[model samples]
Target: MNNIATPEQVTATALLLVGYAAVILFFVVRGALRIKSMADYAVGSVRFSPIAVGLSLAASMTSAATFIINPGFIALYGLSGMLSFGVVMPLASMISLVVFTKGFRKHGQTVKALTLAQWIGSRFQSTGLTRYFGWLSLLLITFIVLICVGLTQVLSNALNAPPLPVLVGIVVFIFGYMMFGGANSMVYTNTIQALLKLVVAVVLLTSGYEHFSQGVHGFLAKLAAIDPALTHATNPQSYLFRDYFEIIFCQIVIGVAIVCQPHLITKSLLLDNERDVNRYLLTAVLVLTVFFSVVFAGLYARLAFPGLQLNGQELKMDKIMSAYVVREFPVYVGLLVIMGLISAGISTLESLIQSLSSTITSDIIKPLLSPTVFSGTGGFRREIWLNRLVITVLGAVAIWLSYDQLLNAKLSVAIFAQNGVYAYFAAAFVPISFGIFLRDAPRLAVTVASVTALLVHFGVYYGRLTPYMQLPVRNPGVSAALGIVAAVVVGGVLYLALHRASVPEKTVAVAA
Candidate 1:
């Protein structure tokens, strides 16, 4: 394929990136000064405005998948993709976020939980369960790989550089600073990234306004001219958007559970006051609504690349957004959008690095070798350094996985990410739900539910038990939805059975 970026654009992007790195380093240094302990590192010592934390939540929640990769799906599949990604998914996630944040924050404050695993372990009073979640959190590395791939695609296309070196550079820079900054620097950086993304979202949405000169119908007519399937509510030709089940039901299920991720759910813990929760939710929901709409820009990209080819080479799904930005915009505007795309990836990448490293350090390693290995002031400092080491190891793993996906993706890295990430949240859905909602929830019930979710999700996907999985490219959403449903059923039954067994004891005590 031809280089989409002009020489001037490449030079400008390099300069823009250098300046971005300098700004990030300034914040990382500033935040590092306040990190005297792991608690400070995980939750931050600085008191931030509710609005800023809200913006951070928004930026963290809307990753490159929303801005870069999901748009590529929309570009390929059209309105069906939009309905699943832009409408149904966003609507469900926003509702779920609002519902879950308050209760989660209340409990998090009571237990002083740093990670999701800690929160679950503390709630159930089980050290073993905490360790289990710590190990299970490794599944999120797939998501880190997804973001790395997305950022590499954007940077490579904008800089007119090769993909391999670009991927390595991204992992090193982001994960390196993340080792020190943790939540302290992350909020400030995420807030800034969120604002830039808002502007870019508008620019991308309007970039194709000329396509609608004859009105909404005219835009659809244009898409229809390219391919009739593009204008359909469901694309029979596509793997993910074949019917309403995939477009609506499965998306709704996934969206509701998606917030269970460590980075997303634990964001509420950053709020120091209960009153801030309302304002935080309001800001996040409003900002996320706009960010999610950026997927509609895929429709714009489809119009730009009518044949999905640039200079005789067919565009990969992951590269579509990058190619669209470079081909459609002037150097200065394209550079700005490139920064926003990078910000989209970095905001979430930082959160994942902070939360995942913290989990491995505090929940996994510290618990395994506590009192014995981490007993004094020296051990405390050692834990902080150990967190950095975890980040370095994660960066190495991300580089390897991201490079493989860049070269040999089946369709999009989103599928691989969703498979792993979906199973995580699917398993987490029961434990977190029971922890937050039920006062006397049985740990065994939630544990069994979590295990069942993992079994069902992977079984349906690898076992090809469903028609959706039987396709050449299976839908992770199908497996995830089924897993969530099975978990709920199993957990609910066990919870009821346990409750009934305790009723006789309560009745006899009251009579005595």
Candidate 2:
């Protein structure tokens, strides 16, 4: 737990953070000036290049989990964790992203949807379902907590500062600017952050090149020498990656559904031109492929901290990457890596704030209050202010939850995040999938499917229905995958039955 960052590193990081803040504010102010309506706030008034939007999507997709947290899991469980997180998951998600983006965007543009809930409501013609999803989006607070904790870990270590003050500063600054900037500022900042992350990814991936002095076999031998389990494809000793079920199957299931999140899937809405979709997807997948490989740096960290101890204190899974950067790199390089790590967290955090607040304002609060309170031309302006207020409230809640996770994570914040975020997308998958792929999607069928997903996901998780969930450090992926499968089955059967029932009615009407 000792501060491994030297004075030079700390000072340089402080200055770099100041510069980062200044640049972010510049964009926020500029973006704020262009905002005249909720639509502008949610999707932006400025025209953005496909490449920039793609980078923003990549940055949003790769959160603190990819850069600062998941790598720690790899460091602990080695190749097994890497396969689940770094390989299988990425491939599944990228494919899912490409598959879902076009259809989702097509409908979204048709409906002029500002949030996922609106998209769902427009697709199924259900206001109740939209409000339901708007409320359900609160579950995303868990993900916000994860990013905050991850950023806190990196900044606290880099600044040689206490975690509490660091956490407070991060919440205030990020949520503050996000209030005004919304999507307009987010895309620009995310693009810059994405570029920085790309540089750091290369630096981190190559940082361990010397470990392969003899060959690839020799590099792995170094791991096996430390522990044979580290070299195994499935680690019997580990909680998450004990077998192919946990390592491969569950990850693929979770990965495909992962794109259903508001921040990730709804990113397609930012592109004004439909023709840019392919280019955007290409940029995101390629950049994300590189970002995902950053998990291998965990192996390098394990090599560096063979005992997983720094200054006689054991390293927490969440702090391993921060410790690795500070200890392994020189002052200047360490500062640069620290900035990249910060960027990784901030990029997604900004997107979450924008998307979630928009949901709360446009989808939830505005709808409920519109008849009485927002029944005029000035309603849009008031709604924009309300969105800012929502961001402020969200910032406060985030501070509370993030501090709790920072202090009392079971294994890592990733688990806490996965439980909530997994359930969200699991529930969302059915409605979104049906809306996109099926022409005559029945509202009742999708609603039943959505509720079933929530029930089954939390049921299997908290009820410990599966052997996987019975473990002390249970895998959320198990519950999420089961939930998605159950939802699809239930929704599909109901849709076919309803479709068949309506077909005979159509035939009778034609005869008449």
Candidate 3:
């Protein structure tokens, strides 16, 4: 009844994972040698190719959620989950990435900004706002927890390891190495991970092909036989995909602004030349299309377990895909899939640790503790050491949060992650948009917009102000979308009014 791996399969997966770790460690150590200062640690010293950066972007953006947790959602909610996650979200996010990357990177590279907070502060010329965002960056720790839980789920299910020990081992190994290697190592590892993920994506997407032997309609019939809602575009009984608004509109809005995050946007800054931007975006969008499609594998899992049980044991949403992989694939193929899932989780985890630690060390801690953190020129050996200390603290925090989410997740850890992650990008959306497009945006306008987004997003969710949120299951994406819309409207009006009033003062002073 239990979802478990056989001893032979577990041994094979563990051995492959160990080999994978050795290969990753080799690359991490190689990249760590390049890290002589905080700058190098933050953005890397090596001149990486556009294709590699693009692959890294794909890998980082499509994390354990796409490969692991999302499938669980699809398995649980059926057709509605697929439409929302696989179709609506991917279309919006890819377009947003292509649209936002050039403008953000142009400004980021011009100012030599290392973090998202730095980009905002430099763009708007507001130290207070930058510091505020640096503190707000703590919300992203929730996402780190999601990835940690996801990695734990995949490993525990595959290796037959207890959750606590597996969780501790994962935290220590990943966080310990992350302290030494930053962006330089992250890009290298992520690129390799992306390549492996591509292979697994094909394997997973095709694994369900047999179910379609009776044609598309037949496959639908099979799903409908299990549960009629499984074939419907809208599952009224489910919390997440109950209506068109939750499935499509909310996802589209959130997707458009999702690029505002540091890990996703700052990826463009890694490229040395502007000409390579097109190639980078092209490669990323193409690869991500495949990565996103991997969510459909959940439908296959559902078909495999029509009753959602093995013997008499019920399958948890988060463990569905892990259990599916172990039950369906051959030992070698399952091991490859497990490695791919691990790669998917660790790729983004590395980026989070890199960006968040740098944000804490460079923007928050240094400003508060000592003004001369990076000092004259680039003699930042002290800053480099400080960054390692920051990573240690972040690692500890990640462990604490991950443990809590694993034990007390509501349905799945994705909700907890989405609540925090969505709120962050919602707050960031207004300022980043204004900074990129509105040349004359006053600091007051951007600052108010950012603050308003934070208030509106959290207010709607916690207060259950919106109808969508009042339900037993609430969608954080709805709150984020509404907050983004509110911010744009309020901030736009304020900027226009402020700009109109300030113009006359300049003219009067010149005439006098």
Candidate 4:
């Protein structure tokens, strides 16, 4: 591929590219030689320490979306846009550390669960639905790949892609790296990438802080200059306010699923012990700090170019941060920013691919390998080889899908899937937590959780609050919040009912 980038930019990006490749390659070779069984392919023999689990968990999730776009959302909606993440993430971290970690270890089930759909089905005793979820999970994963391509475009646009062949080759290389090594290697790569993201974000923030002195104050002045209603964040007097809130939960659907996401779950499951959850908490804090710092750079751009507004029709707000950096920074610094986005993008892509592939094989494929005929160690080997094959095949499928629908699909679907990932786990999180702590919690409660979360998704998301009572309610978060309440209400009520029913044998004792 012919290099289109200025030599300085190319050298900077190339340095990052080579460094990341070396780390992942080492893991890939180590994993292949060491992995003789299917379990090895999926989970690292479930021997990962808390540090690895926490760091890996953090690395896997701090994807290009956060590195590239989420902070900008914070800038756009102020703190309101951050609500979905702000509300969900801390809860998610806790759930991973406290509630869900020990169960995988106790169940002695395979740890590297490939797809949440398959994992949930298997956990709930619905194996037949495995592939159905495999298909849905693939749908979601393809959405992620599209985001990867879109972000690649944004980055290359910043670098001013030298040519089409080079761009295509760049995408192919990132995909190929993950396909070769799978999740284990992706973990190592993500760790390195996550650190790089922090460094780049800090550098830009330190350099750019002077530009956005007014913060919210400056934002108000700019908003007033542009249009007076910017202060009324909640008022639907304008199209901008109306559309922003309307489409907010459109992102949440997948955000809810994020917790249940195969790759994210692997981070929690692969831990050595409960002690390491704190490390994940620390990682989460560090990542968000850097993320916000980067966004502030764009916010500063607002101060520098007070008239700056992301044009929805011709330009993507998603691409603005990169654009700002490229426009402002000299060649070398600009190169680092592009490389950071690429690294984050590649990390997210690899995790989704590896997790999806592993889930299909472990949850959907392995069980079928010997449905009525349970085999021993050799069976695991046969199934694992099948997993590697599944990885190759599905990775290819994702790439093809990316090439086809990758460009045309709404960035929101990918962003929504990326952001709203909390739903998947929310459906599963509370029920599982209750089951662990409360003696009276019934299995039916778990069922209620799954159903209510799904319904909540529709009701809050589609403006259908209740079958009988629909209002002009604007809270996009209401459905998920209420769904959680419904789960607890139903679960709690059922527990009391079951408890009361079991307590009334005093008179019967006398009769006996």
Residue-level lDDT tens digits of model 4 in 254-334 = 343345556665455555555665675566555644553454454444443444443323334455555566556787777
lDDT of 1: 0.93
* lDDT of candidate 2 over 1-512, digit per residue (tens): 48888898888999988998999999899888898888999988898989999999999999999999999999999999999999999999999999999999999999989999999999999899999999999999999999999999999999889899999999999999898888998998999999999999999999999999999999999999998899999998888999999889989999999999999999988998899999999999999999999999999999999999999998999999999999999998888899999999999999999999999987888876646565588877778789989999999999999999988999999999999999999999999999999999999999999999999999999999978876788888899999999999999999999999999999999999
Reference-based TM-score of each model: 0.99, 0.99, 0.98, 0.75
Candidate 2 residue spans exceeding 4 A from truth: 375-377
TM-score of candidate 3 on Cα atoms, chains taken together: 0.98
Alpha carbon lDDT of residue 391, candidate 4?
A: 60
Q: Model 2: how far is 128 from its true place, Å?
A: 0.8
lDDT of 3 by residue, 343-391 (tens): 9999999999999999999889888875564677654777887888888
What ordering of candidates by TM-score runs from best to worst?
1, 2, 3, 4
Model 1 clash pairs are none
Ranking by lDDT: 1, 2, 3, 4
Report the error of model 4 at residue 452, Å. 3.6
